[model samples]
Target: MPSRRSFLFAASAAVAAPSLPIEAQHSSGSGREMKQLPPAIAALTDRRSEAVPIKLGEREHRVERARGLLVKNRLDALVICTGTSLTYFTGLRWGQSERFFAWVLPAKGNPFVVCPVFEEGRVRERMEAKAATLPQASVTRVYTWNEDDSPYALLAKALKEAGIANGRVGVEERTQFAFADGIAHASPTLTVVSGTPVTAGCRAVKSTAELALMRLANDNTLKVYEAAWKSLEPGMTNRHVTDLIGVGYERTGFPGDASCQVAEYSALPHGSLHPQVIQEGQIILLDDGCVVEGYQSDISRSFVLGKASDKQKKVFDIVHKAQSAALAAGKAGTPCHAVDDAARKVISDAGFGPDYKYFTHRLGHGIGMDEHEWPYLVRGNSLPLESGMTFSDEPGIYIVGEFGIRLEDDWVVTPDGGDMFTPQSPSLEQPFSRA
Candidate 1:
């Protein structure tokens, strides 16, 4: 049976694919008669150097932005317990395990880290490598705890030093509940609140630099998708198509963030457990992206193997119209959910479900350091679209036991309205054409 890749795995699967995923082994339909490309990336050469990511200055500015959010949210301090939030503010990359690894950022003073005593050197090395300043980034103070000791006590002590011992402390929302509970237990006098307002405030909006990276990432993903599409041949499994894209990304000098679904399995949005193979005239969906520096890209294009059927073209047109409507409605003043409403309107007018019955998901999601982030384009979210904000403009139509069509592009809100990082699909025949 084919397995559905979870979000984390789906987003970065291309980056870490040593080989085709387990889903590839289960086969379905036969492929079409077409020219075959090299199956392995070993024969291809990387095409370009990677672009630089969010720089030292940008990282520093992000911290200041986060501080402003802290004030607005009435948080005296914020506790970042690993993950993207830590990387976003401090430029430090670390994962959360059983051990306590956290950054305590006080609204009034310097930030401090509570780390393991045995792991100090490596952490310090990473801090030095990634820090915006000469000595450090926000991780200026380091407090250590031995395994025999309580790391939570050290973290609480840091908070006390920051004068937030008895005040409101914002906890990174993604932090494991058990870890948050442990911290609360250790710091009896502290009030813990959600840090999302602070985290999302700093992250949702894209910088010029981030947008450039995204532009490059999206452009390259389309190129990879086009290459994979052209290389399809009769008898090639879905795994074969996936490998072609993987090679295209490698040759393009970026870690791939993509995968493919063939035939009826294309009806499933993330993909289906049904082992489906490529065949002539079957709808094929290539959904993926690559990281340009720290920022990322997510673009999905669906097309046919042979000639597209009338139904295929109709569904594709509807979804494309929905995507275009959402893009056109995007502006600085539009509410996040308003975009979804706009897109949903197009699909509904075209005879789909009145609401989410056919569309199934939101219009799109905020896209930057993460594939799916804040300021989601869902119903009831009123976050105003901002000039620097970026999101995926993807709309899909799924029909049971048949096929699905989704055309995705990365887009950013402009001073006037919004613009795509790459053009939307021109047509199934010439999806990459500017013409």
Candidate 2:
């Protein structure tokens, strides 16, 4: 019987020989193969150079936390296939492709990655630098799959070479059923189980470093929101306003795929901003985000096109009250649902509880690496808010087809209290002139 350490050592040595795919090896072409080119990233303009840098230490902490959990679980290795988790651990910003490649992370050794040849250079140059600072050993091995050899075969071989046979092999929440089934069939001795909680628990809390990037992301989002507000016109269609917001994001050096959503009648919780032209008295809700580094910032702002109606003013006021109540109730050590209840109670007292429909989503979610992270603010989520944890303090009342009112701001639990990441606007009170 091989000791765990010896097993990995022996397998690593035995697998050192380079392996090529069958298609590449037995090409029937006229003695030459057509070479494929790497993907082209869109060229960035001069203005795009100002994109913010993400704090790597926070991400490193997230990875270390997960590694610690793996050790606690007595697992020999983890086969992380989830895109978000992969980025969190390796700092490699690759997306899911038909390629079926993966990163094999051993609990006590260097990480081994299997990817197409085209991606190896970027992954080593960029991601390897970040991985070097990981709490665990940062050595890495790379395997490139060719046309003949499937990436799945490479991954299974890599895992076995790492001595995972008859061992607990960790898999992600979104890992394909087909892939998992294939891996098990490849090695019947391997025991695969869900690694979601292990990953989620590791990423739940934000570190001080993560909070700093989140602050900057929120600030960037606010600037874009201000631009969107300035671009609004009485006759502009909803799509026009939305497109202008996208332009603002670009102007601010945000990534191309930055997320955005516009709501015309927030009172109708699901009301979407359509092609209708904005008139003098319509309310517009813009919920958007711009990517900074690898993290995301999600924020929402509401604006009045030209004037405000009496009904709109009352609705905005109630929504503002609910938002404030929730903020006040949010603090480190408080139950997650407390803030939700606090906001809901205020809306109920205003006689809009039944009409409100309990604020369409959770009070907020973690805001780093990915938009919706962990420690959600909803009924029955008892996780106590902790310092360094951030969430959106958005409270709203929707009445469907008529209008909706929502005031959203990002908040981080601090030693003193909740630190509001996004600043409130001076015009926040403008819509209340009808009172």
Candidate 3:
């Protein structure tokens, strides 16, 4: 297997391999002034189809691993309701509805699904496609209920048949309250516990296959940021920048989500709902990401629309140092709070923060199948850092009514230390590193 640094160096070089122009000119064909900007980064994404993707076999391994956790914890089984957990373990993409739909995997027996009667065919079709992942010998057991019948009763019966009618059952952390109540009501003898030990246990550590998808996702996102920044025009509003971000991601072959904020608006972390137009020489903050397969990448890059002021330069450099500290501090066996502390100390020492007053949020969050997962880089977490955990190393300093500076990149925790998914921004002059 290739090292994360070498893999990223190769991936970055390949994605930006095309000699797409660094600068281009275009007009709206109406009365608007022609704008000169960088070339669309999407052109580099044409090679995305060549990337190897996650295979079905890896998902099978996840389920078997979860079973081991269940037995060790002494829980009867975990009821996987409609969500990413279901898909993560079973490769079944399901949506949540008022009606009951769940997967009952007994720690000691075969895994079975409880679904609506009418949707059984669709469920079976999905299950058959992921044939290698289904619990052994449970293909014939759909165990469904109708609108007039109780799905909970059906699930209860399945549990009884599996010889786990009376024992502790772990409920998904995100399972709706009604589902928990319904499960408890259906079977009076079962105790419920949080499945974080199992869910976060399996998800926080990225498999090689999982890391590959994330690598592609973050690489594509950085390229999109490059293209989006190049395509910027002085008159464009936050919404316009957001649209082009989508264009760049789609052209790169991934569906994406993004938001933009300018000038004073950037001082607010999530940005304002009101429209803010980009102005040349003012602060321009571009933060967005795209999803590669089921995995996700979240990156935020901040730079000025034109020449940055001296104050902007100082603040930008400070935030950059903060990000660097967190990255340097992350490694195997380090406490989660230590990463946040490292970043916070940098900002505080620089006189921009007394603590959380300006550097508002935690250092970063663990990223995976969902945008946010476990092992967060926040105070009080105390979880020891382990290899294969990934997080955003975003550090920022906000000056209300003046400006804000933030630089974000995804990082994978390695055996020796942490490795970034893309190169860090070296200065305000070359935010995208076009130079």
Candidate 4:
């Protein structure tokens, strides 16, 4: 049997592959041509046209905000390597390698970059393209080093020239240890610290444009799940359902995928590697989501293959109520842990928990460009909730020998309360509405 991770990777790759004609599409795992798609999948129409990419102005605003945050955090500059923060600030996406390529943004002056000599042209070309979209773009200085030279030394020199020789510099949270260590070694006078206060401070809150993209992503994922669920058959395996989800996303013109956990395997939070076959009265858990214009959606839905047992119905209702309780507790200014506490309490009171006896994971996680980000909704997190912060409001109950039920939807914190991007699932038999 294929490992769960490998299966998920294959499914994700299939979803990301370019769309082919319905007649030409094949199963990513089996290599068998998908000659006929389910009616629900076949009926899906392209929704990509509705998505709008993030504008250069928004990114400039983000950089300006980051600068303000850097001042507030008392950091003279922020060193951002290849990661989400890089793209978040500059709209440039570059992969990481052993060699260093970093963008250093100071709180007071223009930003500069240090990269391998061979990649300077490529990096500048991309930056130029991004700059063209701006109303009044300024040229960013580039500092290059050959393979034999230390990029960290070049970075240090750039900082020194920018009047930050001995000043405190913040390193973006995801920067590699070697890079950070090298910088520290190259310039012992400079103080290095976590840039999360600046990076997360700027990224935790969503703008109207970001929220719009996320809403579209969640909307698309929920629709794909509903359609895939409608196409389920008694004899189909979990792999078949996974394929359906990938194809559903393809038809909708977005790259997405999901993992299906059937029956007892659902008891595992991330599910088991053992192959699972669908049967009447068995529970099926589907998790994961898709990306739209750099934003992401994470959703999970659990339902029965056919008629649910009384016990299953009861568990589903308990989980559903817990989810709602968590959402209600997610008001602005409330501590992050409060939301988790509220949901855990409901499950515990329902006799399924006693503090993690049944509910396995945190209520939810922060969602945006990354599936999981800052300000997690979990126990002991004292971070206060803020408006425009988006998170997954998921609550679940898992029984080792039985089945599990999870209901997840993306929600954004508003001044008054919070709002879900997609409607809550109604029931195992009718998870999605007819209308």
- Find the candidate with the highest lDDT and give its number: 4
* Per-residue lDDT of candidate 3, residues 149-201 (tens digit): 98888888889899987888888888999988898888788778887778788
Taking all chains together, each candidate's TM-score versus the true structure is 0.89, 0.76, 0.88, 0.93
Superposition TM-score, candidate 1 onto the true structure: 0.89
lDDT tens digits, residue span 22-135, model 4: 335555653333558888988888898999888878888888898899899899999999888888888888898999999889888889889999998998788888884432
Candidates in order: C-alpha RMSD to true structure: 5.4, 14.0, 7.7, 3.9
Which residue runs of candidate 4 sit more than 4 Å off their true CA positions? 1-33, 133-137
The global C-alpha lDDT for each of the candidates, from Candidate 1 onward, is 0.77, 0.63, 0.78, 0.86
Clashing pairs in 3: 38-230, 41-227
Error of 4 at 90 (Å): 1.0
Q: Model 4 lDDT vs. the true structure?
A: 0.86
Residue pairs with colliding backbones in model 1 are: 31-234, 31-235, 32-234
Candidate maximizing TM-score: 4
Which runs in model 2 stand beyond 4 Å of their true positions?
1-61, 73-75, 116-138, 143-157, 256-273, 355-358, 425-435
lDDT of 1 by residue, 1-435 (tens): 012233534443344334343223322353211233344333445545657656677777877888899999898888888877787777777866888888878898888888999989987898877755322454488899998988888888888887766878889888999878887788668877888899988888878887788888888777777766666675666656665676567667777745677777777788854445677788888888887776778888888766888988898899988998898889898899988998999999999887877788899999888778898989999988989899998898888678888888989997666799888887776677778
Ranked by TM-score, the better of candidates 2 and 4 is 4
- Candidate 2 structure quality by residue, lDDT tens digits, 205-267: 666656666776787777666655654556655544544554455545664222122344445
Residue 330 C-alpha lDDT in model 4: 83
Model 1, residue 35: C-alpha shift (Å):
15
Q: Give the lowest summed-lDDT range of ten residues in model 1.
A: 25-34
- Rank ordering of all candidates by TM-score, starting from the highest: 4, 1, 3, 2
